[model samples]
Target: MNLEHFDAIYQRAAERKGGELALESMLSTPLTQQELLSITDDRWLSAFSMKVFQSGMSWKVVRNKWPNFEELFFGFKIGPLLMLSDEQWEAKSIDKRIIRHHSKVMSIAANAQMIYEAGIKHGSFAQMVAQWPSDDITGLWLYLKKHGQRLGGNTGPYALRQMGVDTFILSQDVEAYLRSYKIIEGGRDTKRSLAQCNQAFSFWQQQSGRSLTHISQIIAFSCGDNRM
Candidate 1:
């Protein structure tokens, strides 16, 4: 269901309520800026995913930005991602609804080269990530490329970072994907930290003796055909 796609952000939502609960269940955690950038010739979809998270957007991330971001990243030219100029960031910082941190704005502009380079270096960025381990961002990149809603191609990389997608070489969306899969059932998983949310999913594995795909079936029902 659509909830699986939301697995990454649900943890942040949980934190606003801050209560004592088990934390050992943290399955995946957010990566550092350095770690996010450390990703090498990995997921192209992630690169594009980041592009969708533009530094100057009304929408905060991949969800709504996908349609617009998709339209912008066309043909892997990094056109949209590269287009962000320094002036834009300065103007956007005061934006109330958006994540206006300057670091995020600068990162979006700077990441264009990396995203474009990765695609050229690997021949097919999607294939490059798909070749990597499933738990890594590569898997998320490929899966989203293959399955997520095809927006008009306008994801803002800047917003993507805020939303928790790894902006690096497609190595960070891993936890997000894991979280999405866990979101199939939004109980304890929804209340935990990003790490804890992921942990709950793994716990479910042990308790239910099922795989992510199985959980997805229930998630599909929960989402009423994955609308939200």
Candidate 2:
């Protein structure tokens, strides 16, 4: 059931969305260099932390309390945040401002440390993300999972997408499309599923000269989901 080419995927998406213009609007666009440069390390940490907390929770709850989380984490400033003791983090975990998930609260602290290290080692976390090769975005996902805490699965990719990094998100519709094309197994979610999907995407990048973001959107669009 795979489309013959990228243009076929685009055409199916356009038809599914009612017209070409509508499908164009649904495509994910990466931010410009100036805009990406404007994003600070603190903000990057916040976005990562937010995505970690948003996992398996109501996004509305996360969004509603985001300002409070920002305030509590001291604007997610790496230096001051790295100074927090375990007791301090545990204390905040029980606070009423943000979600009270203790492990997720601790993930904020852990991820902040990861960000601080990335900044020191790579000039800045933003630089690492901006300069990472889009041709191997799965590597970025792997790095996040290994270096940062609790960033595995779709969370890492989704966060990258939110930050305007060129990456793909394997939503259900996208997974279905991948399975239809024999890119991934129809079996349960597994490490093999991720590896195969990543390989398939890298192959498509070589074949189409398009960003992972665009390819992922086209596949999801082909499924007629339209649910970002």
Question: CA lDDT, every prediction?
Answer: 0.39, 0.82
Model 2 deviation from native, Cα RMSD in Å: 2.3
Residue-wise C-alpha lDDT for candidate 1, range 1-228, written one tens digit per residue: 223323323333234324213221322233444444445322344454444444245444635544443343343345654666667556654455444455654443445455555568655443343344322332343334334333122233222333334332212243334345553234321224323434444554455454433332223323322321
Model 1 TM-score (2 dp)? 0.31
Off by more than 4 A, model 1: 1-77, 80-85, 88-99, 135-228
**Best by the lDDT measure:** 2
TM-score to native of every candidate shown: 0.31, 0.90
Q: Which ten residues in a row have the lowest lDDT in candidate 2?
A: 186-195
